[model samples]
Structure formats: structure tokens, C-alpha cells
Target: MSPATSRGPKTPVDPNAPGPMLRYQSNLPKLPVPRLELTLQRYLQSVRPLLSDEDYHRTEQAVREFEAPGGLGQQLQQRLVARAKDPKIVNWMEDWWLDQAYMGYRDPVVVYVSYFFAFKEDKFRTVPAKRAAAITTAALEFKRQVVENTLEPEYAKGEPLCMDSYKYMFNNCRIPKKPSDVAGMYDPFKNTHIVAIRKNKFYIVETVHNGQQLSTNELEQQFQQVIDNAGHIPALPIGALTAENRDKWTEDREILLAAHPENKAVLEKIETASFVVCLDDSSPVDRDQLSRACWHGDGRNRFFDKPVQFIVFENGKAGFMGEHSCMDGTATCRLNEFVCDGLNRNKINHGSEQVRSGLPAPQQLQFQVNDKVEKAVAEAEQHFDELIGKYDLTVLAYQAFGKNLIKKFKCSPDAFAQMVIQLGYYKMFGVSRPTYESGQTRKFQRGRTETSRTVSNESVAFVKAMENPRLPNEVKVAAFRAATKSQGAYMSAAVNAHGVDRHLFGLKNCLRPNEPKPALFTDPAFAYSQHWFLSTSQLTSEHFAGYGWGPVVSDGFGVAYMIKNEALQFNVACLKDLVVGGKTYKNAAYHLKQCLEDAANELRDMLIADMPAQAKL
Candidate 1:
């Protein structure tokens, strides 16, 4: 087990004690509403590097007026504090953040909101059915722990994180509604079947048969049956509707229900399943191909709204896709890590090898369609193809050095990696833009994430120093240390629920519909400062080959990285034709990959030159 998930020592447990997973949940502190003065001060400090001198002055004036005594800022802060102090409210910003950040958004989830994790190869199980069965067995073990609440809660720096999100991790699916989407959670005890998709066809494979969970060999037999029953021909691709725009899909879903009396039951079967396993027919050989396959497959073979989908390809390569509505990546990361770790260690119980005789065949989920439904599916397929064709993804598996070397320099590995990203952006664009690194706020009740603003003044200074040919190694190293220090401090503040973004978000949401807009919010610099040119985050695991998501903005790059013991991995995603300053940059993902490699090399060289001669060994 990874250190983060490992329980160091055993302790006696009382029979009446709460489950280990949620033992501390009731006692977790509520997310705090930061003081108005501190928020504005930090806000100004964060935007300084992203704004020009004139813009900075105007923004400063707006902030000054907003935070004056008896001003609007103070009023909104009071309302937020009152909401936080309410006994009925667990977390002040939880509902609003969910609505604004996820549910209310009308875009398709495939390229816009979903994320993927590419798993390392399983050398011992290369056969597709065997690989799928092993994954399903391990995943069901995890599901058992989660359903029974027996899993240990994750910790960072000795404090337990919120495990509330795990309830949505299994037997859950996102339902498309008109104004906003809602999450549906089925009873885990009752929903013991999984839906497997192959050649655009869906099948129901019961994980539990005759009141007992199927053995690995039985599960493999069921999967093989699904593959054979699906045949070589593709179905009508009803699942493609899931990848269409929210409103469009919402309307078409109603049509589907009205077209046939059996459609609703069929849909319910998929939504209430324990999870999804996609048996892809195509084999992806390279890192890029594998990432694309995992990220967003040919839109036909996926039911995109399922919270957890394990995708297995023809070559036995596998990965996972996550819907972002109900939980953040941390919860799913732990689950995936657990799955990988258990399988790699050969610790999962596969049950008896003897296959049960006279087992039932996998049930095919058939959707009856009319002319309108058929037209909708066709349009959805075309739109999905067009939408996905515009983006590019590239992976850089840097084996030069990683967390081991960063620790030798006496720096936080995450902060150091953030600098590597900043330096890479500066190298390509010749200037720094606004950047966002996700900071988990799970220490607070019902918490999700806070923005750790990455483009600080200190970071700017460090990048510029590295760019200067005349700068000495000692000077560059000094700047780098200062930058990492600044990053570490801000990240600490962010995780503690004192970051500028969420606090400001709460205050902004506090405004009544009829109230006048605040000058601080109307300022152009305010929006620009939050526009993430580099949307970056890190989730590391030795069992992961790659992890990534689409960029938040059209012209930006989504840079997801991993800092392993002896290597660093970066997965970059952006538009294929990214236009900046009237210049069209093709293959932007490849360029960013090269820039990241160069920046990593330069930073390592500078740090090594500054090290003491005896310490170099």
C-alpha cells in the first residue's frame, strides 16, 4: 500500500465503534469563511503578476472601495459567515460550488468535464477476458469495502479527509435533467450486476449469482460470453446520446422513453448497475493512443454518465474514466490506487477456480428506437466526432529524476513540479499567464477543492532569472527556492480553507439578484486573473501509466503530471490549432511536451551546480 493509504499501527476496536471510513466525519470542521480583509489582500497579491501596471492600479482602486468600512464586501462577508454558522448547514459553499462548477454547466461531459487515468500494463494477464475479470474482481473487493464502510479513511499530515464522496463512487450515475443534472445512487446491496459494452452493445453481467459473488473464472466466462454475443456488428449506438450537449440529450432522452414502454426499464438497468466495464475492440499500442482511448473513446461504445467506468481494450490494456459531478479526483484516485495495488500484489481473493455449471448467459440490454430516436443518435455521433477531433493529447514520461531528487534539494516535490510547469509555459510564450493547481479541502466537512494560484510574483522572478543567460547558477537557485517556498505557503493556506477563490466565490454568490454589481467583480483584471491558461494538477501512483483531462479554456493547456520515485510524467492536452496573438500553433501539445522536458533539465542542472561538492554524491 502507498504511505498515504497505509495504517501504520493496529488498534483495538470496540464492536459499537463507527466504521473506519467515516469515523471522524461527524467531527470534521466546517469550511470557514475567510475574513474579508485577508481575502482581498491575498487576491491582490495573486493578480499582480498577471496584470499590467495600469490595470493593477485600477484593480487596486476597485478593491479599496469594495473593502472600505460599511462597504459591499463587508456586507457579503457577514452573510457568508451567518450561513457558515448555521447549524443546519454542513458546509457553506458546498451546494453553490456544485451547481456552478458542475451540475449547471451545459456542456458535454466527455471532453469538457470528465477525466481519465491510464493504468500500467498487467504482464501476467494479457488475454482481454482474463484482464477484465481480474480488474472486476479487484474492483468488487473495493466495492465491498466501500459499501460496508470498512475501508480506512485517507490522511494527509495525520488528519483524516472527508470520505463522504465515496458513497457516490459506486452504484451511482449522473442523470441528465433540464436545468441541471442530478446524481442517482442505487442501493449498493441490491445492485450487484455490472454493465459491459462491446461493439456498441450493452449487456448485463451479474457479479453475484445465486446469492454468492461470481469467482474470477466464472466472471471471465461471462465476459467471454458478452464478447461473443455482441458479435462483429455494431448496434445503433444509443449510448452516443450521452455525449451530446446537456439540453439536447435531455430532450432526446424523453423521446427515447416515449418511443417504447421498455426503454425506461432498460435505462434503469444501466444506471442502477454497480458500474461499467467497456470491452473495446481496438488495440492502442502507443502512449498517445492509449491515452486517447481512455480519455474519450469512439463515442459509440461508452455510457459516459456512469461515475466509474473501467475500460479494457483488445490488447488487454485498461484504464478508468470518471464523471466529475459528485466528487473530486482524490476520492477516485484512492480507489484506483487500491485496485492497482491489490492486483499487483496478488492479494485479491479470486474465490474458487471451478466454474459453475449451467450458468445463465449475460442479458443484452436492448433499446427500442423510432425514427426520431434514430436521427438523434446519428446526430450525436457526428457531433461527438467533430467535437473530439479538435483536441490533441501528448504524454512525456520523464525518467531523468523525480521526488527522490527533489527531496534532496530540500523542497516539496509538488511545489517543485509546479515550478517546472511555470518555467515551461514561460519558455514557450515568453511570459507567464494565470495558472491553477487544485488544492484538496477535504479536511473540512463536505469539502471539495480550492484554487492554489500558481503564477505568483516569486514564480515569475524565478522563471525570468532562468531565462537570462547572464544570471549565475546561485542566483537562479535562490529565486527557485523562494518560488517553491511561496508556492508551499499558499498551498498550505489553500488546503486550510483560507484561499482567495472559494471565499470570493461565496461572497459573490451572496449578492441578491436585485443588488448592484460590485466594482471589484466588474473589473476586467478580476476575470483575467481567474482565467487559467495552464490548468494543472497532480495525482501520482506507480501503477498509473498516464492521467489527464481536457483544458478548461479554449486556448489553454491541461497539464496533468505525476511525480514518481524515479521519474516524472506529464500529460498535455490542448486544441490542435491554438491561435495566440494572431499566430496559429499546430501540434501545440507536442511543443509543450518539449518545453516541459527542457525546463526540467534546466532546473535540475541549476540545482546540481549550486549543491555542495560533497553532497553531490
Candidate 2:
């Protein structure tokens, strides 16, 4: 009678899993043959720094490991090599490790950090989703007005390869409610683990419990146990690899049963992946508390926070911040969808068919973006004097970051008031602003005698005529108005009420009704920490993939990351070291916040002063 839970065709198991789980060995992909890019000592230098403890004894031990007679020579720990060899599973695991290898290979500090995540609760519940969707459709339809405005088309050739290399991530992995829970450090002993795209798909992997490694048969049985227990994934349409012959494919991983008929159970065992509901929210953690969670050991001032955090407010409400480390805008949206699915009990009945497979292989990044942005930066100065004052600050910061990734450049601590003020433009005597229909319906009325339509309208625009280098003052106002008017009208109405004897109204505005209203004065806080966007994890939409992370411990869910290339991507996984009010951002956070406000307001005043004194004179 209740809505049937969707497990979708997989053989059912008792909700209460019964009996012993099996064990299995996974064959791993071959690592690229080592060509020795650097000397043993240098390689040791690279991996040594990863271990924060600099005790001469431990450092000496590592150096010896590096200098072993035949070279560390991928003499991967014998047990590790053996355990990492399950081809089907290990191949995917290798690709996952590549995506996460930015910190260092074999860095235990980064590996063991990914263990947990808090439940994510939806926070933006106030917005009416149905209405928001409608508005999105309308805005996107203005496709004719907006341009692609891409900076470059192809940054690297191997990008697709890199994307394809990790098809497993696209298929079997989902960004968790917090990526840090699975990032940095990994424990080979954990039982059940999940990854996701939030509200889209959830990939579940139940490892054979205890310290014993699994054999393919054991793994197959355990996978079945999961299918028997995890409930059906509605849209996921989980495959019943249990049909026995799935593994007989001579050509690689085709559904084993599709090839051979009798071995269905063994193949189906591996195909037994399941999905859960979507997670539905992004919210900030306590800034102060989180800073304390990500700290380097031995009183060191620098702390590598795990780019994301999760915390419960005093009211027992759960919230999280996507630390800027593990994810960027491009990566966050995919994650947000995964979390949403978990919160909503949504499952990937459908495969991860829509997304990029992830970096399939090694590739280069487009370093030219800086050049294009540089041109834009230069032009900004000529059009708006705001750049004149910022010429020093903007250029300096950009260059500083380029030169030193680790240095912290603290702003002046001196206090100063900052703000932004808006003044509406007027015709003839004052300035004018561009107008795109603005307003909303106050209320709807329905009565036999009352008019069939209720109208709400307000028209306001800003117009500023500035003297061009070659153009005369007399043409300024007219030129400005013409430029603004070029943006044509969007709404056209016909009198539907003509036959009914009353006017029927339909209105469309560029700025949607019920959306966050535009406020001239922004809240004074740090220049939004670049991490404010962290709480809005899974920022990606359709175009790009963004992600980042730090290799450190955090008891307070410290490090946070955010990316906003096109859509948005972000993640907030916990760590044991980063703590709130730590030096990373807190050192000069308040100072920068003040500077940004002052900077914007100062630019505004400059614009007013630069306007032509007499329009059409």
C-alpha cells in the first residue's frame, strides 16, 4: 500500500543480512613503468616533506628506504602489491589515486585522513523549487541575448583521456556528502563506503569485513549480500550480475552474464552495486571552531585544512562548508546532486551516463587564461577609474599568488570604515540606468465583477554618459541611451481579456520575482574568504569540473574550498587538524573585508565624478 521501495530486479535478500560474507582479490592495473624522473635522494625529498615529523631518526629511515640497493623500484610493499592487484577493482582504484595525487604519492598524511562525514540537511528550503525551475527556463531562453564568452576552446589534448581514464569514478564513485571523508588518507579496513554526484547517483562498495583480504568468490558473495540488503535503486535499475557468465567476456568488462549463460551468479555478484537517497543541503560550519581543526604538528603555524567542513549549529541543525581544498565550482555541483540524492533517498537507478568520465590520463592545463584575464584587467582601467586605485592591489595580488603558493601576505591590520552606496539615475538633470522590466505581482484577484487581470509594474534604469577619448560631450547621453536600449524588450502581451471584457496580463522580468532581492549594500565580512562558496558545494552545472583538497587532520572540519569557473563545484570533508581562527585566513581576513568595501565604494564615487557635466549641451 505504501509506495513500493525500488530495488529494481536484483535478487532480493533479507533486509537483515544473514550468513557469512565472502572474500575476493582484485587484479590491479599495471603502474606506468618508472623512468626515474629524479634521483633517489630527490625523490626522498619530495616524499619526505609529506611526513611532517622531521625527527632525524625517522627522516634517516625514509632516506634509507629511498636508497635501497635496487632502488625503491616500485618494490611496493609486498603485501601492498598483492592486495592492490584485483584487476577489476584495482584498476579503478589506481585512477582514483591519480586524481588525488596532487599532494604526493604514498603520503600517509593524506591517505588516512578520509574516514567520515556528517549527515547533510537541506538549508535553502525557503526557495520554491518549482518556481525556480520555471524562472531558470525563462532566463535560459534568453539564450539569444547571452553569448558563450569562452576564454579558450581547447586547453590540452589529453584532457579527454584524463576524463576517460576514470570512467569508474563516473560509474562507481559519487562525491560523498563530504569528499574529505574519503580523501587525503584511506584505510584499507573500512567496511561500507559510498561516493556520489548528489541527488543523482550513489555508488556503494561494501568491503569484506575484518582484516582479511577477499577473493573473487568471497567478493562476489558479499556483493550479492549488499544487493540483497540495500533495497532496490528505483531509477538506477541495478544490474543483477548474478547471472553467472558476466566474467567470461574475452574482450574486457562486458556484463559477464551477457557472454556466458551458466556463470551468472559470479558475474552478478560483482554487478551488485546499489544506490541510496539524495543529500539536500549546503550550509556554513562555525568558522572559529573549524580553524582549530586543521593544524600542522609541533607548533608549526601553517596548517593544511582539508578544504571542507561539517558542523551542527547549537540548535541541533546540521550545516557544512566546502573547504576550498578538495573541490571547486566545477566539481561541487556534481557533488551537491549526489548529496541531494542521499538526503531524498534517491538512487542511481540510472547510470552516471551524463558526466565527463573524469581525467582519463595525464594532461596539461590551459595556462593562457591568465593572459586573457590580463587583457580584461588592462581594459578595465581605461573604462572605469576604479582600476586606477586597484591597479596596484589587483596586479600585485595576482602576481604574488603566481610567484609564491605558500606565502601568506597579510593585509594591513589598521581599521577603516568601508561601504557601497547606490543612487538611481535620472533623466535631464541626473544619471540614467538600463531598464529591463522590474517588479512582481502583489496578489492575484478572482471575482466575477473584478477585472480578469492584475498588473504590477515599475520602470527604473541607470544612464551615465561619459566622454570618450575621441567623441564629443554632446553625443555622450544619446550614445549611452542607445546602447542601453539595444537590449530589446522580452515580454509581448495580447489582450486575452478582449473576448471576456477584462485585460489578462503576463509579465516577464530579467530579474525574477521571489528570487534573492538585489541589495546595494553587501554585508561587511572578509572579501567572502573565497571560501564562502564552500558551503554551496557541488557548484558544477554542465560545463566544467573543479576540485581541490589539503592533506591534514582536523577535528573541527577546518579547511574549505570553492570554485566558480562557470557553474560551481565544492566539497566539505572533515579532518583532525585544522582549527578555526587559525592563521590561514583569519590572520588578515577582517582587514581584507574592509579593503574590498572601501574599494568598491571608492570606485562608485569616481564614476559619479567622471560623468559628463552637461548632457546634450
Candidate 3:
């Protein structure tokens, strides 16, 4: 026995799916982090399958396009140098990365949140809506973060912030699919389809914010109000941009379609995909009639009226439409703050009177990234570039052991984390320890550039631990001491310190050159026991679960990380097709359960032996 498994949860019940109930435990306390983090997600990044040749060529093409003359790259470069700005293509590219690397983990994770809204007609038309948010804050935060921290250090000196995180562009590779390639069968197990878009560039429109959220509906109505008072987009950034002064990017559908360049590939990708839906049952939401008419604009489901709208498509399909460009998932949970700051404070009281006359408002403060880390990143890129010359490998990937895989783990979170680091090391070099089941980090390197690939991260369960009352004080002490001690030691060690420093560059310089760089050097070998007791309800909704949008059901996965109690629960999921069996999910589920049970038993015995007196029931 590994020392962390439960001895039947103190009270009798079953381990399989829901049916009749039995009282094991409830309303018990829990371990801090959820099972998802410990198992499916160790937090940094996860391993993915090897990339196909088709994937590489499409990706390489995107890298070249970024170099297009007077194109997005140039626009971004100009912006960094105080000349121009473009967040559209940048944002779009990121959305693509979420599609691939995170394996569409960026796709909407259908959340059925219960809410009752007070209706304008005085009747609360409360409805249960499906909601989704970006699971990869890393992708959304890429541009801003690179700008804030690691870019200048890894990038060549003098390179534009426009190209700072160019590493992200490789994320756009995927031979664009036609909707026909995947119609009607896009079940929960699948993601992505052909993207449909109107090429009329003139009809395309954009608006930037300076300091506030711009509500389009409110902006349209308040064009006169802002003119009547001091103007802007009612829900937009403070840099008031009324529609009268704005111009529609296109007018004719022909131009819109023609405007988007087509290769034999891109033309195919949008065949099934639809444009970003912007219409509300009755009409297109257009706010251009107000202000000086600088730009013109226009364009769902029976969604919700609240900021967090959820939609449950047929057969477990779901989607989320969030109007937040600046807010993150953390901020989304705090809806009241957004309401106060985004809507109420500046309703129709403002609009057109504040519109800029020419060019556009000067950008707000932009940070200067560090030079050293940029150098290191450039070095890493160069390493991959050099490797490409020496080897013809086409795909790269990494894998880490999960709770079920390790039968005899002491089961401390710190030890589990160290095991992940080891896995990453093993993937890159094909080396793993005898106790590999304890958790090991692995990485596969098979690219010319740093764009290895991304896929949906799945099967992370985050159930709280240590919430049971039957567990003795001695058992509690043994588990707590081992887990905490290991966590603190790793937290204080050098390798983790390097990670902390490498990741913390933008905030303030903490490490000086030639200083002892922190490290964990080697995985720990010990006889400490770690285990936990947890609590559960009749139903549980996993947090941060879903894949990125992609074509074919063959490419979907989901993971939830939460605490079950003293033990961490990581529930991993993938397309039934992707698993080893012809279509049996039980393979993965049983693998995890058996692996966890073994580890728990071993740890319990170890702790019992370590006690001064036999601690038993």
C-alpha cells in the first residue's frame, strides 16, 4: 500500500457513479488545493501528443504571414515603437493557440450556473444558462504579459513589442477545416470546425478602449447623451469613441469575402465556421448612428441577460458569450464589481462630446520588458533552431504521472510536484526513476522553432482532502508533516526559485547574475506517509474543464482539479476514441482509481509503523 488511499471512507458507500445514497461523510473540512491541480494539472503546462506534418506546414505558413509587408506584424512593430496598434490579429492568433496547444482547452466549458435576474418588466425571467470562459489565461495574458515581463529579454534587442511573443504564432497551425468536414456530429467529445467569415473589409469595424468598458447598446443610445453631457462608448474605455466619427471597414458582402485572402487552405477552414455572432433576435446591434460617425459597425441563442450567459446546445453541447476584453475568469466570478464599475457608474451620462478629432488617442502606459530573460528565451529558441538543423524530428510532446499511476507515493503535494518535474525531464531525455509512478515530468522536442504544439488538457479533478473525522490525530500529523515539509523544502529550493524568478522578471529584479540559482537538483527519496480524508455532495461541478475549438471529435479532452479532502483528486477526460480501448473510458478511470488506492494503502501502513504506539481503531 502506498499510504494515501482510503480504507472504505470510514462509512460504507460505493465508488462508482450515482444511484442510491449512503452516508460516508459530509460537511467535513478539506485540503487546500483541489485534486485537479495535483493530478491532471500540476500548474505549469501539460504534455501533448506528437504533431503531424500537416500541422507543421500550416503552422510554418502562419509564421511567414506574420512577416507580411504592412501586415499585422508591421502594425504591431510600429505600435511598440510609438507608431501604430492592432490587437485584433494578435487576439485572433491567441485564440488559435488555445485551439491547438491547449488542444482547444480554450473552448467553452459548459457551466450550468443558477441565477435569477430582476426583469425590466418587473418579472424576474430567471433561466439556467450555459457559460464558458477561457481556461488558458496564459494565452489571453500572452501579449500583455510578454509586454510586461519576458519579451525584450528573450527577443533581439530593438525588436518591436509587436513581435515580442512571436512564439505564440506557431499556435495557429491546423489545416483550416470546412464545416462540411464536421457537420451535425460535433458532440461534446469533439471541437473546432470551418470558420465562416465575410470578406468585406469595409464592413469590418474595430474600437479600442483607454480606461473603461464600452457597452455598444448604451453607446448607441448615449451618442447624443455624451454629446449632451461629456461622451464615449457607454461601456467602453474612457477614450470616448462615438460612432458618428467612425467608418465601417466594409459595405458590400462581395468586398468582405474578397478582402480575406484565401490560399487553397484558408478558404477551406471557414467553410463551416460562422462569423462572431452579434445579433439579438430582433436586429443587428449597431451604434454607428451616434457621434460624428467616425466608424460604422453591426451584428445569438436564447442566452441569458446577465454578463455571464450560458447556452446548452443539443446533446451536452454548450457555449459562453462574455463581453469582457479586460476582465479575466477571476474577475468574472465577482459580477457585482463589474456591474458597478462597468455599467451603473457611467450609463448614458457620457458619449460623443469626448470624441477625438483625428488620428486616435495616444496609447496609455506600456512597460519595458527585461533584457536578460529575453536573451535566455532567444537562446532557447536558438537551441530549438539548431536542433532542427541536426535532427529531422517532426513532433514533440511531454507526459507526467498522475495519482493513479503512482502506487506507493508518500502522497505529499510537494512530492507529487517534484514527480511532475521528473516527468518533464524524462520526456525530453527518456529517463525516469524506479518510483516513476510517484509522478514524473516528461517533454518531447521535435520542432525547428519553439512551437511544439498544444492540445486540450484533460482529466484533472480538484476535490478537497482531509475532511473526514474518523482519521486519527497521529495519521493527520504524519500526513501533514510529510506533505508540508516536502512542499516547503521544494518551495524554498533552487530550481523552483529559478522558476519563480524566471516567471517574476516583470515585477521587479529579484536575482542578480552569478548568484546561486535555486534548484531541486534531484527527486527526493523518503519513507514519509501522506494521506487525506475529504467530503463530497450529491453533485459536483468540476472547475476549468473543456477543450479548445478544433475539427473532428477525435480531438477533445477535459480535466478538473479540486480537493476531495486531505487527498487531491485529478479527474482526466478525453475523447472516447483517443483512449487505448476501442471506446472504453473505463481504461483511464480504472487506471487512476487503482493507482490512487494502492498509494493510499502503502502510506497508511508506513505512518502506522512510524508511530511510537500502534494508532488503530
Query: Which candidate tops lDDT?
Result: 1
The sequence of per-residue lDDT tens digits that candidate 1 reaches over residues 478-582 is 999999999999999999999999998999999999999899999998899888889999999999998999999988999999999999999999999997656
Cα displacement (angstroms), candidate 3, residue 460, comes to: 19
User: Model 2 segments beyond 4 Å from truth?
Assistant: 1-43, 47-61, 70-127, 131-158, 164-552, 555-558, 563-617
Whole-model alpha-carbon lDDT for candidate 3: 0.23
TM-score between candidate 3 and the true structure: 0.26
What C-alpha lDDT do the candidate models reach, one value each?
0.92, 0.23, 0.23
lDDT (tens digit, per residue) of candidate 2 on 131-183: 12221222122211111211111111111001111112111221121122233
Clashing pairs in 1: none
**Candidate 1 clash total?**
0
Per-prediction count of colliding residue pairs?
0, 146, 135
Tens-place lDDT per residue, model 3, 423-459, is 2222322322111111100000100111111111111
Error of 2 at 217 (Å): 49
Compared with the true structure, the alpha-carbon lDDT of candidate 2 equals 0.23
TM-score of 1: 0.98
Better of 1 and 3 by TM-score: 1
